[model samples]
Target: MQKKCTLITAAAGLVLALGAPVVGSLPAMAATAPTSSVAAAATTPELGSGGHVFAHGIVTLTSAVYDQGRISVEGVITERVRDVQINAGHGYQAGKVGAGGRFSASVASDSPTFELRFGTKYNAYNFATVESVLWSAVAPGTPPETPGPRPTLTPLPVPADPNPAPEPQPQPEQDAKQPGMPNVLAVSGTDGGWTNDFETGAVESLFTAYDHARREATVTRPTDGTLHVQQSSDGVTFTDRATYTAGGGIGKFTDIDVTLPEGSSWLEYKMWVEDSSGRKSEAQKFFVQEFPARN
Candidate 1:
């Protein structure tokens, strides 16, 4: 009976020890729940960009420049953004974020609203974050002023000459009379949007012929030898699509059954002029976007 009592006492001590472990494990599990929650909260990332105002009145915004609020998970930075886009006023620019997530864009005005976007890869994948900031909130600058139209000139009347000089004999036939304002409206060509250096000679009066029914895009240019028409869907990389040799000043290329991609609304056209003497003019690019439908 004494041996049975001693055994019962020892079993009670063992039960107490095991019971303490169970109680202790309860607190540990509760602690683990909070620790997991805290770990999850710690991994949540924050994204922001830095803006700088230059003395020349330009406001520059850069992504990944200042990484005060950036976050990392398991030592892997989650907010190292790749592509960055900035839109301000009428201008929109896009580029990839460089090392340290840095990409910069110039704002058009002071206190402008900048809509910034950050992505995970270069010009692909979904955006990681979208952010906006008012220029006034960061650095104050001036908005551009709208200049008035230029003044028109009035020609002075020449005094009547009592004896008008005889007209000189007409020289050899000159080049065809250039149009005062050519019917060919320039979308873009030499002396258009690209630049003003007519080093080789300007390829003027670039026009387009778009057949809505047939979905055709025709481009024309004047003062051409062989006009090379290049097309670009993204406006970045242009590929030479067709070449037309011109016998006269006017060079025209018809549809020839070239169509844009499905649901593609924007197209860019560029022209390169090559003369008989092998002289080539500077290339010019033109952007074409669809107009909104009328109500």
Candidate 2:
């Protein structure tokens, strides 16, 4: 009876195993199907170099902040020549061929320094170079007039519900003049004197008086004429130090070096001109100031 019972139990277990489903087999099939599909789609495409071959690969150029960066051809050659020459304007040249090949060089930190151009042509290929690339910390294509440390801004405190009315504008300062003054010419720092020839007359007037601080002055005359002005420590003595002539009415600029006497405090200037009609114009004061401390 015991043997018969054991045989019956074994046969029942085998029947149950054949009827039940297999666990974890479905997950294996699902994973392998997607993996094979992904592998098939990941094939790498081959790149061709056409007739010309680059041994190091393609060159790329880029810039940072306010700079113009470039990549040009460079390398040594045995058969054909490969040379770069700079022209008058910012120009350049580059190429590769025959027993020689091409290389690439970046624009160094010292930019706007040299022009560039290519040498003789070995084949029908026409190679050309690029022009100037300007850079600065402020903006692209803009250079700073003076280079120095960057500036930082400080925030101001805001008033709480400040309902302040607008203040009245102040009257402009009256031009100082003496009695019987004739042929008055007015000049100011804010005026566009640097680009105008009036600076000549203005500078000349300044030098004829007193130049306390040894500051240099430049005067560009109208009709392209230039006059240098120098003055003695005592306001009485003045000199027309030098002059430069140009073709157009827009005169060239001349620099005037100042040499002041030690311990001088104040300096004054006056300018006058005589016309062909024997009429002398009244003298006009140009610059007056106290001497700055010596460094």
Question: Cα lDDT of all candidates, in order?
Answer: 0.31, 0.27
Best by TM-score: 1
How well is each residue in 8-27 modelled by candidate 2, as lDDT tens digits?
00011111233343121111
Over all chains combined, what TM-score does candidate 1 have?
0.18
Model 2 lDDT at residue 221 = 22
Q: What is the lDDT of residue 110 in candidate 2?
A: 39
Compose the digit string of candidate 1's lDDT tens values, residues 1-295: 0000000001111122322321111110000111222123322111121223222211123211112222111111123444555554554466444553335544344332344434332223223332222322222222222359999999999999999999999763233323431122223233344332211112332343221111123432333322233332222222223333222222344334223321223345444444445554454544433222122
